[model samples]
Target: MSDNQNLLAEQRRALILDEVRRRGGVRVNELTRKLNVSDMTVRRDLDALARQGVIEKVHGGAVPVVEASTHEPGFEAKSALELTAKEDIARAAAALVQPGSAIALSGGTTTFALAHHLVDVPELTVVTNSTRVADVFHTARQTAGAGGQRSGSPVVVLTGGVRTPSDSLVGPVADQAIRSLHFDVLFLGVHGISVEAGLSTPNIAEAETNRRFMRSARRVVVVADHTKWGTVGLSSFATLDAIDTLVTDSGLSEETRAEIAEHVPGLLVADRATSGSVPGNG
Candidate 1:
């Protein structure tokens, strides 16, 4: 195929994957009409994606691979899911940050969202293991400088370590960096939060790095959406009592909320409407 044809084919496959992810499944005829491509072209794209394990090609179309709760999705995939809930949780988590306070943020999609919400807060010393979170601050600073103001940018320290599939920096390097720092608060984003397991993650290296983050901070605040309620990952980071507070969305069930409250009394369930206010205790 020509270079132009190959590029078009790649773009078509991306669109197909996105559609499947959004709708849970997609039909070949639907893709053909939407992408304005031939039926054979759609089939070929789906077949290629299926070979790569991105999707499962059924009789006519494709379906997203069902990832287990213990399995960690890539940054883009996780970011696309629970967007509104993550934003609401992030807004509530951002409210906890005081000006000139030093904070440590663990790497996760929810914490990444928190970084965007925190750009306006001046004089913050943010130490994080996520390169994406660091980039957010960097972009904010550049944008501010371009607009003739550079003083509002926070000091972002990106820890050096091995990058994970979720775009988190982990391993010994990250742990050592976090150990040298002390923060007012540590906002953690985990793969799962349960009354029994507390905070859990899929990767052992990330779990260890998160442990260092918790110890480096005076207070530990967990930022997670409702979907993380009962799902447990491969490794546990912190238990229930170790967390000072939890900022989550209102989509969490009342029964689960009540149960979690027993363990964490300072749970803040963020309402989706009106900038997410924290209801006293769950």
Candidate 2:
């Protein structure tokens, strides 16, 4: 196809996605007939939308991407999706923690996944804003339940502050508490990251609260899924250069990966290939 044709195809894909989201599931034959395009063209459009997480491919059609109805899922609900990717990213993030290190776990499903993997990492000090992350480790500490690295359990510290609907501690109190604590590493799991927008969240107060952790911590390691790329959110906490390392899945686009490597100096891109994560670790 010509460059112009490819560009037009891209435009068509966007329109198709908009239509699918507006009208719910869209059948392949119907879209092909309505748009006066071949079935292959319709299939290609669906494929591209799925890659961007804007839509889901079905047996013969495409459906609007079904996100967690509540972005803030309870423990059981959050555990259901992205379990493997989150675990793999968690292991890589945890390996950065030494036996006697002070670390911070931000609020998110991915960070909560990281909390479970950190169970056996002993002698480390964990300071987190997420009630769930703290509760997970504290419950293990009290119950003596095992399932982590089989080393030693980390010391748990939960900040006292106003809880958001997402069960995350944020606002002035949380920011102050985080600033007072000097951490060896702060693990942030956020909504989106762009070369321009940096690390962002959907809430303004939470974003501001996270900035305090970024300022106080010695190193900032961001853990996110591949889908976070190109996505936009409400508030940006840190620029790309501000983060020390980025640990994400290998599914990120080549263009986005190249952009990050160029814009963010000394940013360690850790995945199964470059990092110690087992292949298919997630």
Candidate 3:
């Protein structure tokens, strides 16, 4: 494109970004009409902004990027933010679990969602430091027994430790317990995910505990939603290269997905339409 064209594109992207930040999100068709541009042009602008890390592209629109390095939201607070996306990601992550495999689930809203899906997997062993995650299984077992049915398998092991604002168990007790055990896979959840900071959390103790979980697991699968793409947290526990697979919702932009695909071995974009994962990278 020419210099004038480039300048016009920049100006249009700025306006597009402003709308996204103002409304919390913007649809492509709406932007096309507002900006008097073609649908393809609006998409291009959104893609550029997404690549710049200033905005996140959804299925047909864009939303402001969240970038908090030190701030940590509580479990209840985070749970209400992305309900649909979390469920989609959880489904994709759960598909990776085998019937009798051992797995570790870290604490966070997304991982907590995954816990509910694992309740019916037979002969599975789950070790988790999050009391909330463990309780999911415990509650399932209780409900099954009440119905006079065996909810066997998926034996839950809750680690002892201090709890964070996100309801994750951390500190020395959790770390020691995780270090001695091994798992087939780990479905980790994080406060943030970024190219520079990787998978991170605001709690230092939780970061350490997550590292122990990573070390004990043979394969690492990060279960995160699209909104986490540009966010950074205070303590980074693992880098993108360490992840064996990443399962996220389809709200992630193609540009962002390609960029992330370069770092991880596999990327699975969970689509609610199909209720399955679309492989980003083979």
Candidate 4:
């Protein structure tokens, strides 16, 4: 094909993929009309993307690849899925924090919830990669000052790096920033956890950054809801034995709990009560 024709083809394919991502799926006829291309051309573009494994070609059209468990959802979407369970787990994890301690928290909705619970803890130095998590501590400091509370605010250190779809900063910048510091404990939020795969995340960059957090901390505490038990993501951050503790809600199955117990010696189940307090097995 001529250079001009090749450029046009590439642009058309880009548009088709973008449409498929935005709408979840797109018909060949729709792409033809939208891109002012022939039906055969649309089909050719779909076929090309399918060959690259970027999209799945269905009977009528194309859809994004089926990677539900490996797909990283945005903060709002994840926060809405397991509200109570995450909150309970966060409460349980927060109870492990001691005053005048330095802690590291990786990015995830569950760990973001844990940040809220740590607001009142005095004399804590928190290092995190989530912009939302940093904002939570920043707001708490502002609120405490407004109320004229004498207790010192928690120190928050936000690492800089490339932002992912989940609003986590990860990459070389974040890894370098964390290497110079040390934390007493590290609270990691993962997309999935299993006996075989251990703690995993959908984003490779986030996985690399999480490993740095583990290296900088003495104790590694994984905070995740029960839904994350069977799911496995694109990258595994830590093995079961490397984790010091696993904090999760009681919704985890008995069989799964038993299996996890064999790997994680310290597993805490957060049980929610009618009084709105979270109790942990500890």
Candidate 5:
């Protein structure tokens, strides 16, 4: 069974809450479809949620514990939040990319923002898995030309492979290409982070490849917003110990922070938005 189906009780409850918040009511079909779990497994999940008063069980679905329109936010609905957090994290992360550095920007809104920030920095090369990020770098080069600037834009390499539903390029081809390069740093976007489950995501193929990326890189810095905390997804490819630093929003709970600190041992936690004083910051 997937971790999403058998997560620790807290992680499972957090997912249920996020689901109800995203989709309002949860029907057996909807839960099974979105989570990629079996119908029986979803029912068991719904039953557990209902027993905790976390949801109201209907004949064929479950409603929110609270009365509200729990509609899933569309991509546009999430854009503003994505932009703000990404900007903060990107700024803090960008300072680490020194001249002559070669780095990989994983496919994610956060890394996409980092690409935009790199426009002014000179003498760096970037490998990426996001088409949108590649376009940004290309545009930045044109902007440089129009301004009569001689500084070259960072080399942008886009991974070629099958695109996932979430718009990430993954699998053997992309992974092999990534393996060919040595990077000073790898900035990654993540779906879920748990103390025991490590770093989990919904796609198995991407998870497998990200595991390899973590192994290949000299440093792996995970960038995520507060929403990922306490959640568990379908696949786990790396452990907390594998991460060098975690940049997230300031909204995380102290308990969650403490658990992660205990698990990752020497992990550094930075609230990208505030206290820009990251661990080891001068």
Candidate 6:
């Protein structure tokens, strides 16, 4: 009877895993209802799955584990994670942009979200290593001109380099291109940010390319969600002190925020917005 119960539990947990993956997240109550199991049982199963590193337990439920130091997810894979938090971070970072000033943007889903917010900035010049970032402006420009009207889109300069899994252009070519140009500010979206590792990435070449981006900018601002705080990637790119500001969402606890604030010059938190057009300022 014990062996049979164990087998049944395994099958039930397998269903839970599938549901989490399909919906990106699942609430405990919903799981209990779906599995016709007690709440405690569902919670126990979630604990077991979390311990296996297959799922991450959140406030009231579980979500797919998208965290890793050495393993980097592809652009589309990352695009689905923390979407609302990304938008919040993006709005906060976009507030730092000054019209007519040249700014550099490193590649990441957060930075891609920021690109959308910057499309209408007049006289802005955007220097980026992400093809997706550039395409945002390109699409905006085309749309504005569809009716034979002038568009106030920013001038986008896309760096030349090999593409990474995250849709970022990195390598000697990208580094050289960045070396020749300078920006008023750089909005960097990193794979991880820790007190020890600082800003880091799994790709060495991308790390080097990011370094160049930093060197060419007068100020550096990091945009990341709360989940990125404790993560440490394989390659360290910049120290915490090197960044001028950090923009994150309210999901971060006060204690963690206080601790991080001690290291960086400025820390800005974006409250979750009701819609995508959240307003923020530097």
**lDDT of each model, Cα atoms only?**
0.83, 0.74, 0.85, 0.82, 0.68, 0.84
- Candidate 3's C-alpha runs over 4 A off are 1-68, 147-151
* TM-score-best of 1 and 4: 1
lDDT per residue as tens, model 1, 4-89: 67555654675677568657899999999998989998898888877766689888888887656468878987887666678878
Displacement of the residue 282 alpha carbon in candidate 1, Å: 8.2
Q: By lDDT, who's the top model here?
A: 3
Clash number by candidate, in order: 0, 4, 0, 0, 1, 0
CA deviation > 4 Å runs, candidate 5: 1-82, 146-150, 265-275, 278-282
lDDT of 4 by residue, 1-282 (tens): 975686566556756765776578999888888888799989998998787666899998998875655688788877776566788788889989999999998898999999999988889989999999999988877776576534666888999999988789999999999989999999999888877898888888888989899988999999987667666898998899998888987666566677777788688887664323332323
**lDDT tens digits, residues 1-282, model 5?**
653433343344445555664466666787678667688867877777666555788888887654222222222333444344456667777777887788888876777777787877777788877777788888877776676535655877888877865566889988888887888888888767777678887777888778767766898888776566655667878888888877764445555566667655333344433546255311
Better of 5 and 6 by TM-score: 6
Off by over 4 Å in 4: 1-70, 145-150, 274-282
Q: How would the candidate models be sorted by TM-score, starting from the highest?
A: 3, 6, 1, 4, 2, 5
Model 3, range 1-282, lDDT digits (tens) per residue?
875686567557756765675478999999989989999989888888787667898898988976666788888878876577798889889989999899999998999999999999999999998889988988888887667536455788999999889888899999999989999999999877878899988888888999999999999999987767766789998899999999987666667788898999999988766768899985
- Tens-digit lDDT track of model 6 for 1-282: 575586567557756776786578999999988889999999999998787666899999999887556798789978876666788788878888988899999999999999999988888989999999998988988887567424556888999999999999999999999999999999999998888899999999999999999999999999997767766788998999998888887656566677787788788887543433222223
TM-score per prediction, in order, is: 0.75, 0.70, 0.79, 0.73, 0.68, 0.76
Angstrom error of the Cα, residue 222, model 3: value is 0.1
Q: What is the lDDT, from 0 to 100, of the residue 46 in candidate 3? A: 87
Model 6 stretches astray by more than 4 angstroms = 1-68, 147-151, 273-282
Q: By TM-score, who's the top model here?
A: 3
lDDT of 1: 0.83
Poorly placed runs, candidate 1 (over 4 Å): 1-70, 146-149, 280-282
